[model samples]
Target: MKVQVKSFFSVLSGGKPVVRTLDLQEGTTAEDAMKLMKVDFSDGAIILINGRPSNEKSVLSEGDFFVVMPPVSAA
Candidate 1:
């Protein structure tokens, strides 16, 4: 199964977009994909599965879309 992963930051920063397509086996967890992408969840990153908040261990299915966002703060 193939999943689309998208990472976006605020538009004000004008940073490069982070996006990738990953091929994973059935029963792959969100944590597994994160590891494959070398993303550390502990860095205040939030994961959403199909537009809903999901935990690292949440199981993923075919055509799953993951949106990862960094923590927001007020300066």
Candidate 2:
């Protein structure tokens, strides 16, 4: 399966917004995907799969668009 990953606010490996494509096997979990992308989960992040709220245990399907973003807070 092909998964598209987008990371915002330096939540991903490079510490910068990035768009990447990762090919994963069937039934890959969101958390596993995040780990593969090197995301920092300590601060708590939001997962959106196909524009809907998703959790780490959510299973992905082919051609899924997944986004990992830092938690939003108003100052």
Candidate 3:
């Protein structure tokens, strides 16, 4: 299965394009996906699956779109 990954922080891909494609198993969890992208989950990043907030344990399906970003802050 294929998933689309959109990252909001450079840490996901060393400041490269925020979008990338990942090929994973059907039952792959969000954490697994992040790992595939070489993203560090310990950063307290926020993840959203199909525009809905989700956790690392959440399982992802084929063609699902997920966004990863660092926690937002106000100045």
Q: Which prediction has the highest lDDT against the true structure?
A: 2
Candidate 1 lDDT, 1-75, residue by residue in tens: 999988764332676657899999999998888878766667666889999998888898999999777766789
lDDT of each: 0.81, 0.87, 0.85
Please rank every candidate by lDDT, starting with the best: 2, 3, 1
lDDT of 3 by residue, 1-75 (tens): 999998777754567547888889879999998888777778578999999999999999988999988876789
Q: Which residue segments of model 1 deviate by more than 4 Å?
A: 9-14
Q: lDDT for model 2, please.
A: 0.87
Which lDDT tens digits does candidate 2 get at residues 1-75?
899999884643466688889999998998998898888777778999999999999999899999989887899
Alpha-carbon lDDT of model 3? 0.85
- Could you tell which candidate, 1 or 2, scores higher by TM-score? 2
Question: Which candidate leads in TM-score?
Answer: 2
Candidate 3, residue 26: the lDDT equals 78
* Number of the candidate with higher lDDT, 1 or 2: 2
Better of 2 and 3 by TM-score: 2
- C-alpha TM-scores of all predictions: 0.78, 0.84, 0.83
Residue pairs that clash (backbone atoms under 3 angstroms), model 3:
none
